[model samples]
Target: MSEILHSPGVLALELSPGATPSSFTLGREAADALARHIADDLLRLLPAERDGAGADQADLLVLGALYDSVQLLHPGWPLFAGLSELAHHSQALAGAEGGRIVAFGSHAGAMPGDALQPLVSDPPSPLLLVPWTFSAPEALATDLGARMESVFMAKGEAGRATADFLMRTLGVRLEHARYLTRHDLCALICSQLEHAGYSALWQMLEFALLYPTRSGEASTARGQKLVFRDGAVHCALPVYADWAAAFGAGRSREERVTDYAGWLFELRQYVALLGAHGVAVRFDGDAGATSLPAQRLAEPDPSLPPPTLFSHEARGLGVVVISVAQIAPDRRVRLLAHAWPLDQAGFDVGLPQFAARYGASEQLVRLGGIELDATADDLAVTLPGPAMH
Candidate 1:
């Protein structure tokens, strides 16, 4: 058995767009929230002073969910640099007992440019924009041991001040901070689930970590049996013995059938246990696929029509479409939104109509079998798409 270690604190900051004064105001509110949540913890928030100074009594410093005002003040500075400066300043303000600085920000479509372009060309600096994780700090402390000295970096400076302020107020460090890859994070999640007795989820998560799905192929076969392994866990339709084969192997047919039935009962129990913990299970044979057709509605037109409304073969069933579009130079659009089932005519016409209404192109390419409610937004939207390989 592996011993699992936990961190002293885990903090999350949400960075989105807002007005200049409003953004700053929101940052302050978020900082206060962090302070309240982690009261009695040594943390310091920043942007309380100019010239990038520190708060003297904090244990950890965080910065960002940066606003436009700060970015405008230092326009030429790379976004992460401003974030780092904010963290450094907060650290200086809070006379902390040498804890890690944690900053949180977006890694998705939040930025206008290539989201993958390094925020800083140099080594790991103060400003580190990291994906929001509900369990990052604990995982980091466990994985990186004592060398976890770190800061959160984000795509922009929009919410940097708020994040910095929050960390400054509520964060405490047991050691230095170190960054973890997305895969590492997922693995940590699996470990947590395993601890929580969600062994099935752990197995599925393990599968997802091992054999990540390709673009649009969220579920696939493992053999003659239709196996659904999403790099996380393995799920499948209930197995059925070929009746013809069973008849041919006539010796002790009843006993073999009884054994198969017993096995299936145990499998159902396993699936039920997963369900008890809010993990969803769907049998493959019972599941229906969402279909989006590919057809060029207009001739060489940049502004294409929307998809038509097709028939609702699977009405009342939830269907999520994951669309990945290349928006600009090195920038891509990954959208995951639920679509109510459509009648066949609606399927053929509704999407094109919607596209036409939205002034988007009508070239519809089908990426198959996305998770029922999963979207591109749920995961990171880096250029060249989500499969790391």
Candidate 2:
């Protein structure tokens, strides 16, 4: 109760075991881009407080296992890519104070900072560690760094039980147990981008080298031009060796997997946010295998219970997240989409604005409109701004 009410702060990053990451500073643009990408998803995992004036509205700390995992996956890309970036969003989140980080369950990834000094040029910053295990307080302290102090301790199952205990002891009905999918994670990234105030230069790929802008200008010094190719929309990367660092290129096999994961995560988030906000939604197929009847979506009501990880499979053929959102400058709505089968990322789902195609993006647009873009594969239309709100 004291922890939930008094310490209205959230430590939302994922953690994993690892050594110190190589030195690299986050660029202002890239840092802002990364922060914008993950904000909403991080907020979702934090505690909420409706009755108090500023009860549940705490800044989120997107640190931990998943964050550490990304560094391990792309060692060359700096450690904790978004912390410095998120610090810019200090008005909303705690940024990188370190001490606010809370650990529940196992923290197999945490390494003592002092030990990494000889190998790592700079160690991780200081953090406030809180452990919620009356069950295993010592292990929790050790994970947070041996001298760490736990803000609260409780005895129960790992996740929801801990949350419930806070609710019971704190006297606040904290939003119940919720499961987040890769889809929601991606959408949060998109949401954060929208929130970050970048109305122009945008991130088309979550883990990519090229993030295109709204105009004819190039995304980096490498000067990659915006071009539509292979049904995937992008600002084509000109030289892998020539403009390597700007795009995070050279790490090919890993980046290939990144596009698939990043796009899929962003897509689901786009669909849910659009639908919950009252945008009309229609799945691809009719009342059968693929699509659901067109309808205004229900706002996520905690009183009705929540969904699990495997829930999407029960819906069949999978839904291509399609919606028209009111993103920057447009008081009205612009279309957005992430059809799983389609290879495109960050498309202007607002098809009437851009030219057409015979691809799945075209299929989704046709559901909302009449004609398709000309089927020339090389022809890609340039959108005026970032596809964010």
Candidate 3:
């Protein structure tokens, strides 16, 4: 039982950006090339599911880092609407069970100097925007460490107190209960103790058992010395089967098992309470599985003129690349472009213009009229700036 409690399985997935081809730029050729690549990857990654079947047969899906906006390629639609539509489609095809989607966005503070302020009010999607001001990696790590330590100490003390109470209530000798750790003993006590009496016993043990300590040495005239300890002494007694049997006669074994199980439940509740109060105790089975659907777009007709490219320069600063991807049955299509630096010097100034150019290009593709719906948001693209000279 103890061994089973100690071992649990967990799975982790990390998504990273793929390499950009040297020929890639903020133009039609780059957009078409990226779109093709993304489509291929998504098809390979997401398994096609049969209708009326449960996800039990489906594989787990984890989205590590998803960026870029397909709406940027087709400015005619609302940005968030496009994103939502795409998410819906992707989740439907992927099968929701055991799925997780974690998107990465730059903390606004990470932007150059004061460039973050203007964008603060109307920040991008909550799922997409992680403000730089609040997302310091080093700071978050340090705080998490402190929180974990505090939680560990609190849980340890609680377990010890619970164990001591069990020993006293059941009249079990401390020596007989030494085989169990404080946590195990606590679990045993909770399982065996009456619900009505458990809280009082817990409070009593807490008030009397946990505290501070001191020690002193006394020397006799003959030079023999002895040590005496004072202040506070904290100790926990072990749990014994006899104490459990004493609680009920006919079903002693069943009662003992029930008591143990009850204790485990209470301990879990306590942990959750601590978390609600901002204590960071790590627990298994705490998070829910989530999924986002892929995006689809209508295909464009071949008779239309080749898509035109719009270029934006950021003065002395490098290009702000924007790429978008749309998901289709056979593959994921992407759109690539860049924002011209606004000589006007405000965060909101040139963004809409860049979005418009990108969006129009996407609309051209959709008009070609492919049978498959290229969910607009299903596409993924990158935004790499100019190389630092």
Whose lDDT is greatest here?
Answer: 1
| Local error of candidate 3 at residue 378 (angstroms) | 58
Worst 10 residues of 1 by lDDT: 68-77
Q: Model 1 scores what on Cα lDDT?
A: 0.32
Top-scoring candidate (TM-score): 1
Order of candidate numbers by lDDT, starting with the best: 1, 2, 3
lDDT of 3 at 32: 27
**TM-score of every model?**
0.26, 0.19, 0.14
User: In model 3, where do residues sit more than 4 Å from their true spots?
Assistant: 1-250, 271-389
For 1-389, candidate 2 gives per-residue lDDT tens digits of 11212111122222123322232222233323333333332333322325211112333333222221112212112222333233343343233322232221112333223211112223441111111111112333223221111221111112544444333432334333222322233344446545763211123233222222221322322233333223222332121222234444454544523332343344344344332222222332222222322222222333332211000111222322333222224322232221222213223333322212112223322121111123311111223245411
Write one digit per residue (lDDT tens) for candidate 1, span 1-389. Answer: 11132222223222222211222212334543443333222222221134322222223333323222112112122333433334433422232333333432233313222321333322222223322211124443343322222322221122344445444533421122223333443454566656864444445434333344521122211122223343222344332333223322543544433433343344444454433323344444322333322222222224332222211111222222323233333333333222322234434655555455434455544332222112211212233244311
* TM-score for predicted model 3 compared with the true structure: 0.14
lDDT of 3 by residue, 207-298 (tens): 22222133433322212222323422111111112223333345434343444334323333433332222222221221111110111122
Report every candidate's CA lDDT. 0.32, 0.27, 0.25
Q: Which regions of candidate 1 fall more than 4 Å away from where they truly are?
A: 1-26, 29-92, 99-312, 318-389
